[model samples]
Target: MIRTSLPLKKSLKPKRCRSCGANFNPISSMSKACSVPCAMALNDAAKAKSAARAAKDERKSLAERKAKLKTRREWIAEAQAAVNKVARLRDLLAGHGCISCGARPQQKFGGTFDAGHYRSVGSAPHMRYYLPAIRGQCVRCNRDLGGSAVNFRKGLVERIGINRVEEIESMQWTAKWSVEYLERLKKVMNKKARRLEKRIEAKSEVNQLEAVE
Candidate 1:
């Protein structure tokens, strides 16, 4: 490899500031601001404006977060209410035994049980929240049967034949009860009942006015 040397020029110079119209003169030619105070003042003013903008943005972000949290809380309450309503319906049906096998004293079963569906909520959207469609299943049996309509139905057909399966699918609910499916079932039930009562009262008032006229 060959070594090379480049010649130095003596005519290099610094440029003037466009804002203050001041020329920069220093040992280093590339200096922009005339003095330390000038540079500091410009930087300080920029920093202050940036801090103000950041504070404003922070307040806006906090407000948006609070609103989002409030909406989430409201949705959670509504979901809890729906779950409680379903539980109340379940309790009423619990005394009758397992809708599938006619098992007695269901709570005496050694294993845990889930509220199983005869006709799946996905298929019967209208009766999705209905209590009679729900049934208690022993964990062992539920797990063994795969916790699905197809699986449960197959098991039922094998155990008691198609005739019994058809009979179970048509049984009606004759009682109402509540269970621990969600938080504060009593409070949710009271609130819903109150709302329903108010609606009934409003309808009755309208009917009374029409009758009077």
Candidate 2:
């Protein structure tokens, strides 16, 4: 006996072009477009849109770069001014002996000195960066005193005796009180004092505000 296989049945269906509304018999049922040109045109449109978006992003990046450069230049100028101000103050305090040790310039023995302030910058803005408040100190003395007014004073008393320190503090000066000298001294001291006072007041105000918040 001979046996034969039955033929597969076909489903009723028609293929259509998505872009041109044309109909054709596609090898597969899932195919949408009738010709390759329709697919290429769709791809080209998508590529053009992507290129436009990239160009827009590049322009935004360049604008951001320019803004950053402008900000950097402004900061550099402010830094230079601060450095110059410090230099001027340093020169003005050179003639004074070590603020801590009272060691005369001649007694320094070629040792370098630092201009120290009685008040630190964080706690006392008035004295922190002022020239008159600065004092020359030998490296060893500065280290021994631990760079604090209280510590330095204690060390000074130990080194020179309390009587001598009292005498040094009591020395009187008689000078022709000139307007120019008074103005110069006030210029140096007053601004710093005012700023320090303002900062303290502001800090207190902020604390109150924070408490309310």
Candidate 3:
């Protein structure tokens, strides 16, 4: 049988020698080097260059993967920080003294305050971020006196009401936090923190002005 198809045209452009800069016409379009030695050299050099690029790319990809993993852990930590910040702000804004002690910051001996948890995060992880479960307390009362159990109950009842306090005590479910949920919670808590900071600042200025008068 005879093939009757027209012949294919070759590339007209002169190709540069892969091993040297000399220009030459390729015997066929697929030909890379002008001579045998140049072809072997070119092949080796091409292989080495390709290997180097692959290694560099692998290193870059590895670093990026590690960074992505780190983000989830960082978001979780940020969420916790934001929650604590908001809780502390809430206590301060309410003009309440320490939940474990009746002493105000100025009136207290050490004058340090912390957002103390009523149920404790270890026992009630579900209520870890519950606003009503936390209240302001002097450092001594919170840490030294073991959350000052006696006064803590009294303060919790007064601040959040008896019913709400009872509800928190009755809570028994575990709260599951995902990376995505924590990221969203961080944003919300951060916004609340900013607003609370502004309010606190404004109130401080007003108090200063009044004292001066």
TM per candidate: 0.30, 0.27, 0.62
Candidate 3 regions with alpha-carbon error over 4 angstroms: 1-67, 71-74, 106-111
Residue pairs with clashing backbones, model 1:
92-177
Reference-based TM-score, model 1: 0.30
RMSD of 3: 13.0
RMSD of each: 20.7, 21.9, 13.0
* TM-score ranking of the models: 3, 1, 2
How would the candidate models be sorted by lDDT, starting from the highest? 3, 1, 2
- lDDT, candidate 3, 34-150, per-residue tens: 899999998899899999999999999997687467666587667877887798788787787888777787634544887788988777778877777878788889888888877
For residues 128-203, write the lDDT of model 2, one tens digit per residue.
3344334455565656656757655665465457886566445444334334443445455555545555665676
lDDT of each: 0.56, 0.55, 0.82
- The sequence of per-residue lDDT tens digits that candidate 1 reaches over residues 1-213 is 999988875654766753365877644565656778777777787899999999999999997676455543354445444553444334433333444454443344443555565665445433444544455555554455655566557655654578877876765544222233223443575576566556656766887999999
Error of 3 at 144 (Å): 1.6
- Decide which is better by lDDT, 1 or 3: 3
